[model samples]
Target: MKEKLSFKKGHRGRTVFLICDVIFLVLLMVCMLIPLMKVLVDSVDPSTYGLRLIPKKVDLAAYKYILSKSSLYQPLWVSVYSTVLATVIGLLLTTLAGYVVIQKEMPGHKLIVGSIMFTMMFSGGMIPTYLTIKQLGLMNRVITCVLPVSLSAYNIILMKSFFEGIPGTLYEAAELDGATPMSIFARIVLPLSKPALASIGLFIAVGMWNNYMNFILYITDADKKNFQVKVRELILSDGLSGTNIGISEDMLKNAMVIIVVMPFLIIYPFLQKYFVKGVTVGAVKG
Candidate 1:
């Protein structure tokens, strides 16, 4: 009788827990949705500038005005080129580093990993970094914005952990088959590393896409700023003065928020499967 009661109690508890989980998820969706709906509705609303659940009239002038800015194009181009270059370089270095460190027979494997991890704990101060960049004559260059920030210690560790999860027999077999390290990496390792690559590449791409501090610090040229910097200026500034575009600050702000996040929303769905698998693999192995 006691065992029966205990089982009944446990079953009831699980039912309650599941219900609570569903409730929590619904509430979270509501919280997120309300803000998104407000932004979407307000961006096109011609109504007076105040919070409302619905719009009086749909006016798309804000998006049109913002899109028409010639200044926005240069920053968009900068972000595109810089993000692509940075992701490519970051993935290449991360893959190479992860592959090398996983080869326990390689000289200084632990030393290399330890050195990489040490960076996560400490960094040269901003002043010293600035001086180093200045000395290298890279202060105002686009490379300055991407190269320094590209190789993340965290990503390297994650990649290393992911690679470690791969079966060692595969490497041994390749070696026995007279496969060179480069050939094995390109042919065998890379084919199996797609999940880790997607996860890390997405991380690097997002980081570079949203990067602004580097541009703000390294580049002095007004025309060379990234979209993030331009968005910051737009959000913080008094409404575009001396312009005939009849749009409110709130509309532009909402539109900017949507524009910035839209790319990730579009890209993430495609990579969701790989990202989930990769993150799980890296996390468990690490």
Candidate 2:
């Protein structure tokens, strides 16, 4: 009778837990979706009133007005090119650093890895960084944006942990077949690490795509500034001051927000599978 009673209590507890879980998930969905719905509704609508679930009338003038501007095209292209270049270079450097740091037999491995970790907690101030960039003749160059932020200590550590999870036997087999460390990394390790690479690459790409500070500090040329910088200028200043567009300021802001976010929305679905796996795999061992 006691055992039966205990089982009944346990089952009741599980039922309560499941209900709470469902409630929490529902609340989370509502929180995220409501704001997104508001943004979507406001983007095309001219309503300056408080948030609404749906706009009474839909208008495409805001989008049309922004798209008509020829100046936006250059910044869009600059953002795309810079993001792609930075993501590629960051992955290469991160993978190399990760692989080297995980080799137990390598001299000074601990010290090297430790130094990389130390950077996660600290960095030189903005003035010093700017001076260094200036001294290197990187000022006002697009490459400055790519090179300065390429190395991430967190990415290297996550990658190192992922490398450590690989069996030592695989490295031994490759070595016996006269494979150099580089060959093993390129042919074997890289192929196996697609998930991690995709995850880190996505993060780097998104960061580079949204980056405004880099342009503000390093890039002086208006022609070289990326989309975010342009968007920021539009947000801070009166909307289309010199341009003869008649769109409302709120409408333009909402439209620009959607325009800026749309690319990431389209791209993320394709990479979602790799992303989930990558986040978990690197985290599991490290």
Using TM-score as the measure, the top candidate is: 2
Clashes of 2: 0
Kindly give the stretch of ten consecutive residues in candidate 1 with the minimal lDDT sum: 238-247
Q: What's the CA RMSD for each of the models?
A: 2.4, 2.2
What TM-score would every model get versus the actual structure? Answer: 0.90, 0.92
In model 2, state the lDDT of residue 211. Answer: 88
Give lDDT tens digits, candidate 2, residues 1-286: 9999999999999999999999999999999988878888887777647979888899888888889889899999999999999999999999999999988789997899889988989999899999999998889999899875667898898888778877889999999999999999998999988888988899889889988898999999999999999989877877454235566777777788889989989999999999998888789877
Query: What overall lDDT, based on C-alpha atoms, would model 1 receive against the true structure?
Result: 0.87
- Candidate 1, residues 1-286: lDDT per residue as tens digits? 9999999999999999999999999999999888877888888886746657688888888878778888889998998899999999999999998988888988888898899989999999888998899998887899889986679999999999999988989999999999999999999988999999999999999999999998988999978889999889877785433135677777788877778777887999999999999999999998
Q: Candidate 2: give the clashing pairs.
A: none
